[model samples]
Target: MKVKLMTALCFLLINSGMLNAQVKDQKMGELIDQQFKFADQQYKVLAKNLPADVMPKTYNATTDKVVTSNTAWWCSGFFPGSLFYIYEYTQDAEILAEAKRRLTILEKEKNNKGTHDLGFMMYCSFGNAYRLLHDPAYKDIIEASAASLSTRYHPAAKVIQSWNSSDRWVGPVIIDNMMNLELLSWVSDHDGDKKYKEIAVNHANSTIKNHYRPDYSAYHVLDYNMETGEVLKKVNWQGYADESAWSRGQAWGLYGFTMMYRFTKDKQYLDQAIHIANFMLNDPNMPADMIPYWDYDAPEIPNTYRDASAGAIMASALLELAQYSNKAESKKYLDASEKAIRTLASDTYRSKLGENGGFLLKHGVGFLGQNSEVDVPLTYGDYYFLEALHRYKEWYL
Candidate 1:
């Protein structure tokens, strides 16, 4: 009788463990499936609505109309990342082919010297494209972009310069440039170039010193004297004036510093990332979804729209932070991130089969001032949302 009772208890324990593992696996599978479904649906809609003959470099969606502008650099990365996600999930050759073609088109315009958004436009999209596809031509394109980006590095200021033509921003370094340093690090690794790594580290350190406000919220741009390496000013180009924190800028700092910590394992970068993330998570104005509007200081109240892309970016970074830090405090941030992702996957932000360009989440503001694609579908929003979902599955579920 005693032997039989012990055997039954062991059996129950084994069965419970198996059941728990199975449940977790099922949850992850469901999340990945949802992300793939969202991506697949968006791809179909974009392919159908956006004509092939339409110039890829000139498309911009605004509230009034979809205008053709010569400088649509940032959107370039968003579409490729979206398509890449679809290809990753399905392994469909057609998806890969289309992404490759789009990347090829982007390759041509990489050296245009028009904007300061090279990382968003080129590296994140084209560099990631090359990394996944393993195509030599794409690699060449990224290498060239890395070179161009390296030229923007102001050695005296120990940071990358923004706005090439005029002194209007002659010594200015923006938080957005933090997103660009990944390319430098990648180039340093790929081509055995020490200068690339040095430049990237210098730029990251400079931003760490100059850009962050006392509250951990950061300025959009900082003017540094190129000759003296002195910070002349910290200005807000995108946020409300008087040094308000732009929600997206904060996200950029969180994401960028997290990346820097990943590469260097520097505690300062990790600390900075955690500081900004804490501010964002604790802010009263942030919605339940953990996504904020373009500016935290925007006058609009409950009606203020949220930036889904910000949440997406921060979610990805938070997952990285969770892995990087093994403390109770880190767990708090991770829990908050999981909650945010759960909110994003819930009905509030999620889209139906035939709404808002079939994107997974809605109410993403692309350009607030222009009212362009305000509270509408954004490609990066979709990409990062799917990415966070993928990471969630890989880690917890």
Candidate 2:
């Protein structure tokens, strides 16, 4: 299976900057055609199948079930966000209407202070809406969401809280929190308050100090002694163990720091992004096709299930990373990203027509340690895959 997947993604290794080369090559042309065709078809099916108000997380093939959540769930935005991505790609009228409907429903969550995924939920949905349409209402929604997210920041901890003081953790700050900085940074630059950007940079610097090990691998969660402003413990909530590198967590860190460098032109953040990318691409366990196991430390090793979502996120981040680096460094990052994109575009990771719960990508592992949404199609898998496609086209095509 892995061998075939690698062969399929080989074209992704072709320099997409050579658009003329792709135009001349019939095989590469066919791959691009198939990819977008699959994207459009998946969205059309997803638009009809998904419930209007609920957001999909994953599908259980055995139970023939679509596991879903309300607006309060951390993953709630990806469903609408994926729609906006498809709408942008296809320009289909029905997709646009469906995306708008879901975006409106998602806009209500802007003020929810209970969760740290406001960036994933509000920023991904409304950010795209505002970006594409320049809607003033969407801008307001994002600002409110940023304000709500800002409330999660603890002055002493200097980091955004991932979850409230739960029974298992006290003021947990997860690697996933890195992703929320983009929303904060965006709000600050768009004629909004500077406090947001300041908070974001503080959080990034703090995470760099406390959340990373010597090898640059990140911990999934950090428990803080907020009153004392100390890191209480490094632990794992979603990973295999405290020291294990969770695949999605690594991707979040990579993407977040790369984005930070883009916004602030901070060489430290860019260096961090490059360091993390080097660790990932050089890891002995990374598959030949560039898709990663759910947890880098999983005992299962070669047999462990793959997380296409992580690959998608990593690819998108590396595309941005390529743009920020010098020529020699940029080629290495871009090549790595292109390899992952090809693997994701392959049938091994992508869903077959009318299969896989109407999602574009498959084989994503979400919280396998908790036995939740393990080895299933994830909404985020599709969302970031679309984002990777757009980034590739924007920079290389």
Candidate 3:
């Protein structure tokens, strides 16, 4: 009798496991199909309205206007990435052909001396497109951009300088620079250049040591003494001026450290990523969906606006981090990310099919300076949302 009972228990466990696996596979297929349909429709509309000559330029959705101002260098990456996603999902030759044409234009713009965003603008979009397509022209363009970016490394300060001009940000290394390290690491592996890897590692080490607070939240910008290689000031350039933590900066740290771990397999980087993620997840003031306001501790919480773009970007990063962690608590983080994506897919933050000038996301902040795109649709928000959805389908179904 005991032997028969044990046999029944084992059979039940095996049957349950099989059922779970089948459910996961089915959910993954559903998510992928939804994304493919959405991308197909979006690409057709964009291609029909947006001129081919302006293939990679930034545009404003509120007024259905093209941005003729100084180009938003890093922000333009979303356009190419969006198109590439459509190509990946649909295998439409026309979409891939258009992506190649736009990337060629971006390659020419890299020759300009004032561009400070080679990684965000080119590598994330065109370089990633190349990685997927295995095209030689994209490889050549990425290599050249890597060389140009490496020139900004200051041997004295042991950090990469933030901006090209001698303006307010002169000699300062902003937190956003952390996101650029992946491009260098990618270039190092692709071209067999050790210097690029060295620079990336050195910059990451310096940032981990100095930029992060005990809570795992980070400053918006850190001004370094260029000569002594010492920390000068840690200021909040984007959020409340008095040392507040910007939500997107935390997302960047979470995403950046995760990428570093991916490249180096360093436990410390993964630990830092986990720590920062915990801070964001456990903060009492964070919204129910795990999305946060521009500042976590901002005053007037009721009126404070949410940055959906940050939530989307962090969800993608958290999914990657979940694959790397062994602790049970890691599953909690992954679950939270899944919930966040579900919230985004709901009606609250995402634009309807034909609303808001055919935009994907509803509330995104751009260039705190101009306050131009506050609470409007943004290209990066859409790209990151799609990316999170894609990752969700891959990991959790």
**Of the candidates shown, which would achieve the greatest TM-score relative to the real structure?**
2
Segments of candidate 2 deviating more than 4 angstroms: 1-30
How well is each residue in 1-397 modelled by candidate 3, as lDDT tens digits? 2453355335433443343333333454675576567666665655555565554333465367644322345666667777787777688888777777667656665554355577777777877698688878777777777778888887777788787546675567878888888888998987647798888888889899989888888998888877778887788888765467788888988998999999999999999999999999998888776767767877856355577788888888899999898878679778878766766655566555545544566666654445655555677777777778777766776
List model 2 lDDT by residue over 26-107, tens digit each. 3533565567767888777766667888888888777776778888998888987877777787787788888898887788
Backbone clashes under 3 angstroms, per model: 0, 0, 0
Rank candidates, lDDT, best first.
2, 3, 1
TM-score of 3: 0.87
Please list all clashing residue pairs in model 2, or write none if there are none. Answer: none
| Superior by lDDT: candidate 1 or candidate 3 | 3
Q: Which pairs clash (backbone N, Cα, C closer than 3 Å) in model 1?
A: none
Best by lDDT: 2
lDDT of each: 0.70, 0.84, 0.72
**Root-mean-square deviation of every model:** 11.6, 4.8, 11.1
Native RMSD of candidate 2 (Å): 4.8
